[model samples]
Target: MSNEMIKCTNVSFKYIKDSEGDKKEKYAVKDVNLEVKNGEFLVILGHNGSGKSTMAKHMNALVIPTEGTVVVDGLDTKEPKNVWDIRSKAGMVFQNPDNQLVATIVEEDVAFGPENLGVEPSQIRVRVDESLEKVGMSKYKRHAPHLLSGGQKQRVAIAGILAIQPECIIFDEPTAMLDPIGRKEVLKTIKELNKKHGITIILITHYMDEAAQADRIIVMDGGSVKMEGTPKEIFPRVEHMKKIGLDVPQVTELAYELKKAGIDINEKILNVDEMVNELCQLK
Candidate 1:
């Protein structure tokens, strides 16, 4: 079996707009090529309209490329026959939890995916319980989704996807609409899914801290991928990231400022702990 889970070959996508009397094409993703390995934690960072979400949609076959191909787990997303299979293997969680929930009760929402996939009723019950437990929402299994906190709702939304038993998941700005607390909850769940469950994670986020947790990061800009590297490599290029309208992690930015003031701190420091260690060394 191949370790590669998703691959995009020279992918390009453009949206068509009807002008005053004619059609105009505006490219959202342009000639991008990338590969995601099975069980890898990858983050895509981009400003608004930078095409990160568009690329994510291709993985789930929600959108087809205008000029290239996207293949997920040996299934070609461009092929109509493989669309459902690709979606089943690579589930997606969007920005709004409310939009993803399909049932009144938490457990029912979680079971929705497996039920649609024709999983036996008994197995579906098992999956719903297991998925809710994984997301730390088992206690709220019978609660109404709409009455739950934003963070709780988001966790339930994630549970829905988990019930499908996907090999990979694409999260498109899942925390954008979340409060800080909610963001923390969702991010923790995402990390657990990737680390504990060994599921492939392709997280599309503008949050620098979230991107820092990724094994590898891809920076997108103006419909093209501008940079790709590990977090340590990507965050240290502070000025370049700013030029492209992205911010580095808070600690990284602090380190960069300290370096400018002639302090002997590593500009690559990504977190408070790393900064503390470096500062202690100078003591």
Candidate 2:
């Protein structure tokens, strides 16, 4: 098997505009090339309209590039026959859990994906159980999805995708609609999915703290990638990030300010724990 789970070569996408007898095309994603290794965790950061989400859609074959190619798990997305296989391998979780939830009952919703995939009935039962357990939602299997909290609902949604047994999962701002606690819950689950389960993750989020957890970060601007590096490498450029209408993690911003004040603190600190340790070293 190839080490790469996804590859986009010189990909570009344009949205068609039709109004008042005018037909024009506006590019949402420019010529971009990227590769995601198996079991890699990649976070994409961008301001609104930067095309991060559009680029993500290509991974799952949801949006085919107007020019260039997107290959997922060795299957070319532009091929009609490969579409189903590509989608099965690369499942997507959108921003809104409510929109993704289909069944009324939690377990039923979790089962929906496998059922559609034509998994054997007996195997579907096992998968539904395992998926819920993976997401820490097994205890609520019998509950109605409507009754669960926002975080719980989102976990159930994740369980649904997990039931599909995808090799890669693209999370398009999964925590945007969530509360602080809910965001924490979802982020933890995401990390475990990638680290423990060996699943490839492509997360598109605006939260700098969330990006800090990824193995690599890609910053998008004007429909193209502006910066790409590890969290330690990317978050240190506080001025550049802010100039692009994006912010570093709160701790990183604090570290940046301290460095400007002539303090001998590490400017690349990402989390509060790191900041505390850096401050203690000043003595």
Candidate 3:
């Protein structure tokens, strides 16, 4: 029993550099098939140029599939008439918070999306307040957007997207620009949105630790899915990930090391506590 929120079937994309030259178009993604269930927290992992961002763009109709289809909540993204609806259904939060915030004040910025959609002023106020509360930025609603911290700015950006009442959100390296604390703040907000509010999350990140928090992880290599599984299933195979230019979580690596040193530990460790418990049980 799966509630499919997003589905990609035989999807592929190629950026044509030359229409008549010998260079076949640059393939960003190829024959990619994925299904994200409603309320699921899915993470997409890949190195730079591995096609993760390209796929993220597809979720919101920022980029259409050159072949096959990307359907979000039953709306085909390629449909010209459904473009606006598709974008609304799958809101986006990009890597930089600075670029996303357009208005000077936080509340006004949050209201931008709803305003673009022609939502009434009274209703927009309610959504803006609620969205800020969801991201723990309610108090900052009246503050100037530029005065907020990097984390705060990012949350406000997320609030802007949430203000639109989207069914799903696709984060394209959303925490890449923040400090460690800022990153934590943004991650916490995202996790709460998925766990408490049941907002579907599609997180694209290079940080293995961040990916470990997801319900499922899909590894991309050469614009195709190389591995797909839970963090426990994916991180244990350190060799495989290393071969693809990705790193396993630190705790997972530590557990693997201990196992190699003749310690009796299960190789798949996602966090420090799990590694500690495994060591405590050693023979």
The TM-scores, one per candidate, come to 0.98, 0.98, 0.97
True-structure RMSD, every candidate: 0.9, 1.0, 1.7
Name the runs in model 1 displaced over 4 angstroms.
none
Candidate 2's clash total is 0
Model 3 — TM-score against the truth?
0.97
Q: Model 1 — which ten-residue stretch has the worst lDDT? A: 262-271
Whole-model lDDT per candidate: 0.94, 0.94, 0.94
Q: 1-283 in candidate 2: lDDT tens per residue? A: 9999999999999988888889999999999989999999999999999999999999999999999999998999999999989988999999999999988889999999988889999999999999999999999999999898888899899999999999999999999999999999999999999999999999999999899999999999999999999999999999999999999999999998888999988998999999999999997
> Model 3 lDDT vs. the true structure?
0.94
* Superposition TM-score, candidate 1 onto the true structure: 0.98
What are the per-residue Cα lDDT tens digits for candidate 3 across 159-255?
A: 9999999989999999999999999999999999999999999999998889999999999999999999999999999989999999999999888
